[model samples]
Target: MDNANTWFDYIPFNSRGKVGKISVLLLLIAVGLSDFVSASILKPYFERLRPSHSELEGLILLVNKGGKYGFVSSHAANIFAASTILSFFYIHKKKLCLTIAFLVSYSRIYVGVHFPGDVIFGGMLGYLIAIITITFYSKFVLNKNKKKLIG
Candidate 1:
């Protein structure tokens, strides 16, 4: 949020053990999937224009305009996916992770790139993807290991 580079900077280094490494990998995959879904799939399907491109009467551009379509913000989707995964790994840091995601998502609106609806839907989509990825990881990776240990 405050610094764009800090999102996944220290998490990988700080995380410990096999689970931590796998989680970091999965988190990266989640972010990639969110971005791909938002930008490549949904954006093309919806074909909504960015507010800057729409040319509203009093719209002030704080940052350079983005691509043509803005149905779902990739920034929101990626950050939310990262935040959701981080929260799963560090339950105590959920607030910080969510706060970062929210701030980054809001920045898109602040800079006049995406509509509120776009950001909201992107965030929801990212959260859903993260939930699915986490469920699969737990059910397949963690549970299988547990079963082996028990057996």
Candidate 2:
């Protein structure tokens, strides 16, 4: 449980079958890549300025200054993507994960780096990407009966 330890200890390797594990792993990868694409591509495309970059009158800077553009918050997208992926496997903890995602997204706005709309859009982008990933994962990756995955 030490922070210094590697992340392999956290993967649910034993409980899930081979395909299930593969699905989870791929889900993680896809969500991560999706968030990266959103940040790398969409931010520059939108050309929205961060509050720090803009000379606002009363903007309280909580965190350090970020890059030039900040249309969609990358932090929000990444965290929400993780929450969505986790929610697929852990139905019981959906609300908790969502709340955590919401709070994390809100932090971006609270930090004055991104607007409320930016965080909201980032969260939606993550969710939509996750939804697409899970749909493909469910249809192709999971086995018959639609409940579990088998190798």
Q: Tens digits of per-residue lDDT for model 2 on 29-148?
A: 756776787778999899999888988998789889888888888888887777888788877778988999899999888888988888888888888888877787778755455555
Top lDDT model: 1
| Candidate 1 lDDT by residue in tens digits, 27-144 | 9889999999999999999999999899699988998898999989999999999999989988888999999999999999999999999999999999999999999999998899
The prediction achieving the highest TM-score against the true structure is 1
TM-score of each: 0.91, 0.80
In model 1, the Cα lDDT at residue 24 comes to 86
Judged by whole-model lDDT over C-alpha atoms, candidate 1 comes out at 0.91
Please list all clashing residue pairs in model 1, or write none if there are none: none
Clashes of each: 0, 0
